[model samples]
Target: MVLHTVNCPPSHPALGQCLRLLAPGDALLLLGDGVYAALAGSRAAAELAASGAALHVLDVDARAAGVLERLADGVSVCDDEGFVALTERYPRQQAWY
Candidate 1:
Protein backbone atom coordinates (compact mmCIF):
# COMPACT_ATOMS: atom_id res chain seq x y z
CA MET A 1 0.00 0.00 0.00
CA VAL A 2 1.16 3.55 -0.67
CA LEU A 3 0.82 6.23 1.97
CA HIS A 4 0.16 9.75 0.74
CA THR A 5 0.15 12.94 2.77
CA VAL A 6 -1.57 15.88 1.16
CA ASN A 7 -0.86 19.11 3.01
CA CYS A 8 -2.19 21.52 0.47
CA PRO A 9 -5.47 22.70 -0.97
CA PRO A 10 -7.65 20.04 -2.58
CA SER A 11 -7.83 21.97 -5.84
CA HIS A 12 -4.09 21.80 -6.19
CA PRO A 13 -2.81 19.83 -9.15
CA ALA A 14 -0.86 17.55 -6.84
CA LEU A 15 -4.08 16.21 -5.38
CA GLY A 16 -5.45 15.25 -8.78
CA GLN A 17 -2.15 13.70 -9.77
CA CYS A 18 -2.05 11.68 -6.59
CA LEU A 19 -5.61 10.49 -7.05
CA ARG A 20 -4.87 9.40 -10.56
CA LEU A 21 -2.03 7.24 -9.33
CA LEU A 22 -3.83 5.81 -6.31
CA ALA A 23 -4.62 2.09 -6.29
CA PRO A 24 -6.95 0.06 -4.13
CA GLY A 25 -4.17 -0.88 -1.77
CA ASP A 26 -3.09 2.72 -1.30
CA ALA A 27 -3.92 4.92 1.69
CA LEU A 28 -3.98 8.65 2.30
CA LEU A 29 -3.10 10.33 5.56
CA LEU A 30 -4.35 13.91 5.78
CA LEU A 31 -2.05 15.67 8.16
CA GLY A 32 -0.58 19.11 8.85
CA ASP A 33 -2.36 21.51 6.50
CA GLY A 34 -3.86 18.62 4.57
CA VAL A 35 -6.61 18.15 7.14
CA TYR A 36 -8.65 20.76 5.29
CA ALA A 37 -9.42 18.18 2.62
CA ALA A 38 -11.42 16.18 5.10
CA LEU A 39 -14.25 18.67 5.08
CA ALA A 40 -17.54 17.03 4.20
CA GLY A 41 -19.07 17.57 0.79
CA SER A 42 -15.81 18.83 -0.66
CA ARG A 43 -14.60 17.91 -4.12
CA ALA A 44 -11.38 16.62 -2.66
CA ALA A 45 -13.24 14.38 -0.24
CA ALA A 46 -15.37 13.08 -3.07
CA GLU A 47 -12.32 12.41 -5.20
CA LEU A 48 -10.65 10.60 -2.36
CA ALA A 49 -13.68 8.40 -1.77
CA ALA A 50 -13.94 7.63 -5.44
CA SER A 51 -10.39 6.34 -5.52
CA GLY A 52 -11.38 3.34 -3.39
CA ALA A 53 -8.32 3.83 -1.21
CA ALA A 54 -8.28 4.02 2.55
CA LEU A 55 -8.53 7.60 3.87
CA HIS A 56 -7.30 8.89 7.21
CA VAL A 57 -7.07 12.35 8.75
CA LEU A 58 -4.94 13.22 11.71
CA ASP A 59 -7.25 13.83 14.66
CA VAL A 60 -5.15 16.65 16.00
CA ASP A 61 -4.97 18.42 12.70
CA ALA A 62 -8.68 18.03 12.13
CA ARG A 63 -9.43 19.50 15.50
CA ALA A 64 -7.03 22.32 14.87
CA ALA A 65 -8.61 23.08 11.54
CA GLY A 66 -12.06 23.02 13.18
CA VAL A 67 -13.16 20.34 10.73
CA LEU A 68 -13.24 17.35 13.03
CA GLU A 69 -17.05 17.27 13.01
CA ARG A 70 -17.26 18.03 9.30
CA LEU A 71 -15.23 15.11 8.03
CA ALA A 72 -16.62 13.13 5.14
CA ASP A 73 -18.01 9.65 5.64
CA GLY A 74 -15.61 6.69 5.43
CA VAL A 75 -12.70 8.84 6.54
CA SER A 76 -10.94 7.58 9.63
CA VAL A 77 -9.57 9.88 12.31
CA CYS A 78 -6.20 8.65 13.53
CA ASP A 79 -3.76 9.45 16.29
CA ASP A 80 0.02 9.22 16.34
CA GLU A 81 -0.06 5.52 17.09
CA GLY A 82 -2.50 4.94 14.28
CA PHE A 83 -0.24 6.91 11.93
CA VAL A 84 2.68 4.71 12.91
CA ALA A 85 0.60 1.63 12.31
CA LEU A 86 -0.34 2.90 8.87
CA THR A 87 3.30 3.50 7.97
CA GLU A 88 4.13 0.01 9.13
CA ARG A 89 1.41 -1.44 6.97
CA TYR A 90 2.25 0.64 3.90
CA PRO A 91 5.78 0.34 2.62
CA ARG A 92 5.76 3.41 0.40
CA GLN A 93 5.03 6.97 1.45
CA GLN A 94 4.46 10.02 -0.68
CA ALA A 95 4.31 13.41 0.97
CA TRP A 96 2.63 16.14 -1.02
CA TYR A 97 3.47 18.99 1.25
Candidate 2:
Protein backbone atom coordinates (compact mmCIF):
# COMPACT_ATOMS: atom_id res chain seq x y z
CA MET A 1 0.00 0.00 0.00
CA VAL A 2 1.15 3.51 -0.72
CA LEU A 3 0.61 6.63 1.33
CA HIS A 4 -0.58 9.45 -0.91
CA THR A 5 -0.25 13.05 0.18
CA VAL A 6 -2.31 15.60 -1.74
CA ASN A 7 -1.23 19.17 -1.12
CA CYS A 8 -3.49 20.87 -3.65
CA PRO A 9 -7.19 21.60 -3.86
CA PRO A 10 -9.70 19.27 -5.54
CA SER A 11 -10.01 21.40 -8.65
CA HIS A 12 -6.37 20.85 -9.54
CA PRO A 13 -5.57 18.41 -12.29
CA ALA A 14 -3.14 16.67 -9.97
CA LEU A 15 -5.92 15.82 -7.53
CA GLY A 16 -8.05 14.35 -10.28
CA GLN A 17 -5.15 12.25 -11.44
CA CYS A 18 -4.37 11.12 -7.93
CA LEU A 19 -7.95 10.03 -7.32
CA ARG A 20 -8.13 8.25 -10.63
CA LEU A 21 -4.97 6.25 -10.01
CA LEU A 22 -5.61 5.41 -6.36
CA ALA A 23 -6.11 1.78 -5.43
CA PRO A 24 -8.11 0.29 -2.62
CA GLY A 25 -4.99 -0.42 -0.57
CA ASP A 26 -3.73 3.13 -0.80
CA ALA A 27 -4.16 5.77 1.92
CA LEU A 28 -4.85 9.46 1.26
CA LEU A 29 -3.83 12.34 3.49
CA LEU A 30 -5.08 15.88 2.89
CA LEU A 31 -2.76 18.72 3.79
CA GLY A 32 -2.23 22.33 2.82
CA ASP A 33 -5.03 23.42 0.47
CA GLY A 34 -5.97 19.81 0.01
CA VAL A 35 -7.76 19.97 3.35
CA TYR A 36 -10.60 21.80 1.64
CA ALA A 37 -11.49 18.66 -0.27
CA ALA A 38 -12.66 16.99 2.92
CA LEU A 39 -15.17 19.61 3.90
CA ALA A 40 -18.71 18.36 4.18
CA GLY A 41 -20.92 18.51 1.05
CA SER A 42 -17.98 18.76 -1.31
CA ARG A 43 -18.07 16.55 -4.39
CA ALA A 44 -14.38 15.93 -3.80
CA ALA A 45 -15.12 14.47 -0.40
CA ALA A 46 -17.75 12.24 -1.92
CA GLU A 47 -15.25 11.00 -4.47
CA LEU A 48 -12.75 10.25 -1.73
CA ALA A 49 -15.35 8.27 0.16
CA ALA A 50 -16.03 6.19 -2.93
CA SER A 51 -12.35 5.51 -3.56
CA GLY A 52 -12.37 2.95 -0.79
CA ALA A 53 -9.00 4.15 0.41
CA ALA A 54 -8.43 5.26 3.97
CA LEU A 55 -8.77 9.06 4.25
CA HIS A 56 -6.93 11.33 6.64
CA VAL A 57 -6.64 15.09 7.08
CA LEU A 58 -3.93 17.02 8.87
CA ASP A 59 -5.56 18.47 11.96
CA VAL A 60 -3.48 21.63 11.96
CA ASP A 61 -4.35 22.43 8.37
CA ALA A 62 -8.00 21.58 8.79
CA ARG A 63 -8.29 23.82 11.85
CA ALA A 64 -6.46 26.62 10.12
CA ALA A 65 -8.99 26.52 7.31
CA GLY A 66 -11.90 26.33 9.78
CA VAL A 67 -13.13 23.11 8.23
CA LEU A 68 -12.41 20.77 11.13
CA GLU A 69 -16.04 20.69 12.18
CA ARG A 70 -17.16 19.97 8.63
CA LEU A 71 -14.89 17.05 7.87
CA ALA A 72 -16.52 14.28 5.89
CA ASP A 73 -17.50 11.03 7.55
CA GLY A 74 -14.73 8.41 7.79
CA VAL A 75 -12.06 11.10 7.52
CA SER A 76 -9.60 10.87 10.37
CA VAL A 77 -7.77 13.86 11.84
CA CYS A 78 -4.05 13.57 12.57
CA ASP A 79 -1.22 15.73 13.83
CA ASP A 80 2.35 16.32 12.64
CA GLU A 81 3.60 13.25 14.50
CA GLY A 82 0.85 11.21 12.93
CA PHE A 83 2.08 12.27 9.49
CA VAL A 84 5.45 10.80 10.37
CA ALA A 85 3.76 7.62 11.53
CA LEU A 86 1.95 7.34 8.21
CA THR A 87 5.24 7.45 6.34
CA GLU A 88 6.40 4.59 8.51
CA ARG A 89 3.25 2.55 7.95
CA TYR A 90 3.45 2.75 4.20
CA PRO A 91 6.84 1.98 2.75
CA ARG A 92 6.06 3.96 -0.36
CA GLN A 93 4.54 7.44 -0.65
CA GLN A 94 3.28 9.58 -3.51
CA ALA A 95 2.96 13.32 -3.11
CA TRP A 96 0.38 14.87 -5.42
CA TYR A 97 0.70 18.61 -5.78
Q: In terms of TM-score, which candidate is strongest? A: 2
Model 1 ranges off by over 4 Å: none
* Per-model tally of clashing residue pairs: 0, 0
Error of 1 at 61 (Å): 0.5
True lDDT of residue 58, candidate 2: 98
| Candidate 1, residue 67: how far the Cα is off, in Å | 1.1
Model 1 residue 82 distance off true place after TM-score fit, in angstroms: 0.7
Per-model TM values vs. the true structure: 0.93, 0.97
Looking at candidate 2, the ten consecutive residues that score lowest on lDDT are 17-26
> What's the lDDT for all of these models?
0.88, 0.95
Task: Output the TM-score of candidate 1.
Answer: 0.93
Candidate 2 lDDT = 0.95
User: Which tens-of-lDDT digit does each residue in 1-97 have in candidate 2?
Assistant: 9999999988999999989988998999999999999999999999999999999999999999988989999999999999999999999999999
